[model samples]
Every structure is written in C-alpha cells, then in structure tokens.
Target: MGMEYQLFYWPSIQGRGEFVRLALEEAGVAYLDVARTKGGMENMLAALKADAHPSLAPPFLKAGDETIGQTANILLFLGARHGLAPRRAQGRLWAHQLQLTIADLVSEVHDTHHPVGIALYYEDQKKEAKRRAEEFIASRVPKFFGYFERMLTRPEHRGVYLLGARLSYVDLSMFQMIEGLRYAFPNAMARLEPGYPGLHKLHAHVAARANIARYLASPRRIPFNEEGIFRHYPELDEPAA
Candidate 1:
C-alpha cells in the first residue's frame, strides 16, 4: 500500500519531528513528510492557524482522520499502533514515562543554546548561553545519564532496550537524545560517556539496527546544524574532563 500518514514539520531542521520520524522509520511505515512535499508547507502552516483542533507547532501527525500533536503524544499513539510499545498497560505507561523524561532533557538542551530566550539570537545571548551550556555539561548531563543508567539496571529492565528485549519508541528516542548531545556537546559527551556504559551501548546498538542504519545513510536523515535544537557552538562545548 502507499504511504497513508502525513507528518507535518519543518523540512530543514530535524527538530522535535525527528523523534516521530525515527519511530516511523524503524517501524518501516510509509509516510510523507508533508512540509517536504510541494505546497505542503503552506497547508501545514494553515492547519496550525486553523479553527479546529489546531496544532500548536510542527511535528504533528495526520493519521487518517485523527490529528495528533506533541512529540510524546504522537510517539505514544504510534508506538501502540505500530508495535513499538509494550502490549501491557503498565509496560506502556513505563515507556511513556521514559519518553517524558527524554522530552525534559530535550527542553533543557534547547535552553542551553537559547538560555535568555528563543526569540533572541545566539549571538545576542552568547554570554548567557555559555553559562547555561557549562551548567548543562557539568550537572544536567550527568544527572540525566545517571537516571538512565540506573533505569537500565532495574531488575525488570532489559539491558538491551529501555523497557525490555523489544525495541520501543523510547529506545529510538534515547538514541536521538544521545545523538543530539554528542553533536551539541562533543567534548562533554566524550568525557562523560565512559561512565555511562549502558547508555553508550544502547546508543550504539540502535545505530547498528538494519533499518536505522539505512535511514541514517539516506537523505531523510537531516544533517545536524545550528538551526536545529542540537546546535554545535565550540564555546558551548566543554573540554574533555
């Protein structure tokens, strides 16, 4: 069958849409990136301003008649429908909880570059960004990684994946998180990653998956740049400790 779902997001930057893209890609689901299509971006923007069930931002999913918004909510729906989530309620809830944590991490990462305000240019907030990025590298990164490391060690947890043996949406998200952090804070990650063996292993494992490997090699994988959430500013990166 042809691709049925329409993913509405900024065509240039990976942004929050990448989480949804990874889930769809790993599931091998055929879907069109609406904004990437001709005249589709206009439609997406119009939908954002529409009167009915308007999406507040990009990364919204149009699945048949349902319009779903929010990165976590979109993943939750896709996970259950596409077998990327646990079949059991408790397991599913755990996956959602993990995803929420990932979202929290993402927001903090964004704030590091735009500490003063997203409306302000990075050049305009260079001083504040430097301070925020330092704090993120020294404290936030470890605290988040510490939680993820502990989560992997839980008795019920599967060493290979966040929830269990099966790859879930949370796993894909975790992969994205690691990728973003490494891109945005290479030195910090290089210094900090050795302490997070499990997270490092999982990140490697996800990248090695057949589908993901193919996806990364394809045009669908947008190059990480300053326009995206995970920006690389040499001054923001810490020296290896």
Candidate 2:
C-alpha cells in the first residue's frame, strides 16, 4: 500500500479494535499498531486532542490525510478497499447492516458485566448483571443467532458466510462474536451450538482460514481476559436452553 495505515487503539485488550485488526491481518495489509508503538498511547491521546477531526474514543484509523472512527465505519472502508466486501451497493449495505447489528450485540455483552455504568466496578453491579445475563442468554442470544441463521439460509448465501458465497468483513465479525461468546460463556455456547449449526460451521470455517489461523497462533492476537467486553464471570453466564 502507498499510504501507511496507522491503527490507534488500546494496547492491552482485543476490544473493538480487533475487528479492524482482523481485516488488515486477513488482507495481509501492512499497518502500524500505533498505540503499541513506543509512546503510542501518548501519541494516540495527543492525536485525539490535536487532530482537527476529534474521535470520541480509540480504535480510530489514520490513512494519509483521512481519519476514520467506529469499528463498522473502519471495516466498511477497509472492506471496500481490500476486497473484503461485496462489489454491489446492495451487498455492501447488507454487510454494513450486519456489522452494525454485531456492534449492538457487543454493547449488550459489555453491559451484561457492567449493567450500572462503565465507571463503576463489576462487583458493584453483579446483581444487575446476573439479571441482565439471564435475559441475554435466554433471549438475545437466540434472537441474534436466529437472524444470522435466516440470512445464511438465503438462496444466494448458500455458503458458510453471511453475505454471498465468499468471506466478507461480516463473516470475520461473526467469527469474533463466536470467539467472544465462547470465551465468556463456554457452557452457554456449548449448549447453544447444537441449535445453530450454521453459525458454528461459519465460526469453524473462518477459524480454519490460512490468515486467520496464522493470526490466532501469532503473538499479535491477544488472549481473552477479564478486561475485555467478553468476560467469563461464572455468575454472569449460564448453560444454554
């Protein structure tokens, strides 16, 4: 690539930024993980304050003169440029819509562990979290998976991906979703996986991709921990119905 791709995100967790990282890694694009660089966190904070276009949070991407924020927005831009998205306008919109839906699920997942507020500790909200988790595990999980299940059953989407016959950013996002859900709710996923065979198949297929498999084995991929959106709190999760 002519322009240097600079990714500004927190250095520790695989948060939202990991979605952007996955596209870049899959496409074999060379980019600098700016925050991981020397004084990278300082640089990211400084850029946020200094740049003419302000971003509300991290996981922003800078490419030459243009800067983009939001994981879906970043993925949309990268998908079009890197052949990670469909060619038609309708296909593109469908993919973007799917990504936005995934974003919604991510937010819900985060809230399961922090029902009160991000400023408060999880311990402060465990009771609420448990209630929220019950609804989420019993309702939201099947609802979201059902939507994708229907999409995959479409005539055009005969393959493992959510879009067309090929893998798009949406598929990658689904892979990330599965990874997070499994890490956070192993028993729930194990029980639910049987019902959503297509989703599990998609997840396994994406995991087997050459680039993704390599990325998984690499040091670059951060392991899931307590800090990320998907956290494994024994009380916050339950076995699937």
Clashing residue pairs, backbone N/CA/C < 3 A, model 2: none
lDDT per residue (tens digit) for residues 1-241 in model 2: 3536999999989999999989998888889898988999999999899877768998999988898998999999999999999989998998899999999999999999998899999999999999999889999999999999888887665788887579999999999999999999988888887898888889999999999999999989989999988899988778545
Please name the candidate that would achieve the greatest TM-score relative to the true structure: 1
Instruction: Locate the minimum summed-lDDT window of 10 residues in model 1.
Output: 50-59
Residue 202 displacement in candidate 2 (angstroms) = 0.8
Clashes of 1: 0
Measured against the true structure, the TM-scores of the candidates, in listed sequence, are 0.97, 0.96
Residues 1-241, candidate 1: write the lDDT tens digits. Answer: 2777889999999899999999999999899998988998898999898826677888899888888999999999999999999999998999999999999999999999999987999999999999999999889989999999988878777658887688899999999999998999898888889999989989999999999999999999999999999999999998656
Best lDDT among the predictions, by candidate number: 1
Task: Pick out the ten consecutive residues of candidate 2 with the lowest summed lDDT.
Answer: 155-164
